[model samples]
Target: MGIGQGSATCGSRTTCGSLDVKLRLFSSIRKYYLFSKDTAQVAFFVRYMSSQGPKEELLGLLPLSGQTRGEDIANAVQKCLEDNKIDLNKIVSIATDGARSMTGKNKGATTILQSKINHEILTFHCIIHQEALCAQTFPAEIVEVMNLVIKIVNRILSKALYHR
Candidate 1:
């Protein structure tokens, strides 16, 4: 998404323009043969203002091996930023799903990342995550109907003519 103007001052040694990064993490279990493996994936999207105007783009998708602790998540993000040659001081804010590993006060990814930066960065829980949590409170009957509708839609979309 296009972010606001890049007026934030850079605290690092470099004088590059400021940027705002949004981070989202997804964890799942995949079955390979008879064994199941836990996998974690992270997606980073950055917004910055260029000469023309505001711009946003996907930085990269990183797959984490083994356990996805607060430290692991933070390191993955740090590596991505470094690989892209983006300075840590340019980060104006970070948005996460509010998971314990991401939001934990002492060792959360955001907390750790903030410490690495010279200036304070804004942190907030994603609204989509909040909506998903609220959806869980929906009545069973309503949820069932929604699921049935999704199935019907999927079946229709699966057909070539219907999809077209």
Candidate 2:
């Protein structure tokens, strides 16, 4: 991995490879993906920067036979990390859907991982969920316009001439 000697803006000018610089670089090195659990599986993906820019890889997935509470999810995550020989300290950001079990104030997976890692891990709610919420708020006029457009497109596409 190319470790570019990055700089950090502190109260005073720091030299290259300083603690601040190393911390900043380390934090930006990789992203942790904390996916939601709907069934009985818990999984996470790893997104890292490379010569080709950001690429995501599936770390691992573990099945849970019991309850899917925050504690259970946290344990499964821990096992996945251990099985994959991944260090928790490298996790910079955790991305998950906004479920109570995933984002609960006291016992969510994010909170549990933060506590175990003892780092101020950044948390991000899934953008798809946010977009869905925003979609629900679209004005009636805009929805009607979109419906009309969809109908027109469907009608056109259904025609034999357009099928070609």
Candidate 3:
């Protein structure tokens, strides 16, 4: 069946139907290694099928100050889920950018989260990241053109007036 058109509300007690509710969590972490300091951040998003239809929402964007390990990412995801009152049992899968911290067999965030839950959950690398990885193999001429386009876009976006 085609997905119905409507936005789902996610509150302390979301009213989304319980049956066949498949929750998919997508996470991506970005680490910045500067000369003076290091910083890392993670963004969490959730997709689910509600009674009305399918819906998606951003759960949180949190920073990891010290170390961006699997445990730390798992803890941040747990906190975000708990804060949103989302039951871990509802989650059917978790997708990430395929970073070692997220996909490691022993100490990855997905592994740790799966250990916390009673049921099996699917884990996969996000397709967007995979596409980006593939793009890296493009011819140098195409890459140069893409980079030039990006520079032009950045130049336009950097202007305050362009935001309006």
Candidate 4:
């Protein structure tokens, strides 16, 4: 699903159940067409569990200039929050990959954001990232097999040769 439009509470309890409800923020940096040049931009997203299961929305993309320090990520997130008018308090947690620029001890994006939002917002490394890390522990043979299978599947799908 998608995030509700307009100014609505992000993690409101749905009628489905009284289970834990939270708004999750996810982000990533990627190359995008800007000014006809390939540039790295950080794209932010918001996610939450709803009655229909889960929902997410693309917050915004910030141009990454020079080194992407901790403060840079914090500023990008703050600008996104301001532009979208999303209440900082409503953000129950932030999920990001375990990058030094994100979860560093002294100066990190999450730390900087906590200072700006004035709350110890719950944070964690992305589950997918954790799983990938775990996968690295598998034997090289298994990893190679998985990679080969992935490549074959990707090629088949890209060529529209896969039926069903």
Candidate 5:
């Protein structure tokens, strides 16, 4: 659909002043979402600690409902927070892939899900933007290497992607 870009909102408020208390440093990781048109497929997340530490899989989301909306995601996340005993007050920020769905306006999933539930939770975009920045600064040789890798991956996965 022409890569329509939009975010989401929840339109709710968490406990008072809870946001200021949490959302310090963002997760040193990345958030990924897998969705089939009009339905959320999966949400894959990873958090890295330092440069050498093991990575954390925040969630491999298969939402309870086969068809999930932004609000559904928001509420589910709230449940996860409580179930995992993660105090929202302690969370400083979130790291997402910066995709439109993850950072949209009204229609974006993130905006729809967090409208009021978390007014102050700071959301961060992953370093994908940085990767683009790096490309701009790269030497021709480095660019060639990157392009080659991408071509190889595409060739290797074309069938799989097409089938899907």
Candidate 6:
């Protein structure tokens, strides 16, 4: 659903049954594209300002669908909130799996989030994503022969042997 509240509040669901937090379009890691230009990753983090807890609890998913641009991430976040009838002012901070497109120097999702939400929206880089980025930053060269050898080894192994 696009960013907007439904007539039924999230809290109402609790009284009716359970606190059903509607989720966004989900995808499995194995089904994800590793480095495809057609895809982008998007993530959002939320914390309730209410010390008493919230009508809807926040969620921090480890990996999000590929969302390459800041606008795309912002749109996804907004959409999620709207679908769940979450009050932006009630949000405290947001921790995300930092992607440059989402956390760039300016006009990034972090900065854009501040603009979109009157509440304090703090964007933090996830440790895991950061570590992965660090690992990718090192300058190294892999021998083509070595890569071919690994491919051959992979071909000999079962799919179960691949962790990801």
> For residues 3-109, could you state the per-residue lDDT of candidate 2 as single tens digits?
45454443235543387788887687656655675668876788989899999988777787678788888888888878778787878888887889989989998
Per-residue CA lDDT of model 3 for 59-164, tens digit only, reads 7887786899999999989888898898877779999999999999999999999999989999988999998999989999999999999999998888748433
Q: lDDT value for candidate 6? A: 0.61
Off by over 4 Å in 5: 1-39, 42-55, 64-68, 107-119, 129-142, 147-164
Local distance difference test values of all predictions, in order = 0.82, 0.81, 0.83, 0.78, 0.60, 0.61
Clashes of each: 0, 0, 0, 0, 28, 4
State the lDDT of candidate 4 residue by residue for 1-164, as single tens digits: 77664434434434223343222111112234335556657778889788999999887878877778888888888877887787776777889888989888779998888876756689989999999999989999999999999999998889885467
State in Å the error of residue 164, model 6.
30
lDDT of 1 at 10: 32
Between prediction 1 and prediction 5, which has the larger TM-score? 1
Model 6: CA > 4 A from native: 1-67, 133-164
- The candidate, 3 or 6, that scores higher on lDDT is 3
lDDT of 2: 0.81
Q: Number of clashes in model 1? A: 0
Q: Per-residue CA lDDT of candidate 6, range 1-164, in tens?
A: 77445556645665555322222223344566666554444434454446776644435332346645776676777767777787656655666666676677686767777787776666677788887778575555535655677898887885555555
lDDT of 1: 0.82
RMSD of 3: 12.2
- Which stretches of candidate 3 lie above 4 Å from their native place? 1-39, 141-164
Candidate 4, which ten residues in sequence have the lowest lDDT sum?
21-30
**Model 3, TM vs. native:** 0.62
The estimated TM-scores of all candidates read: 0.61, 0.62, 0.62, 0.63, 0.42, 0.44
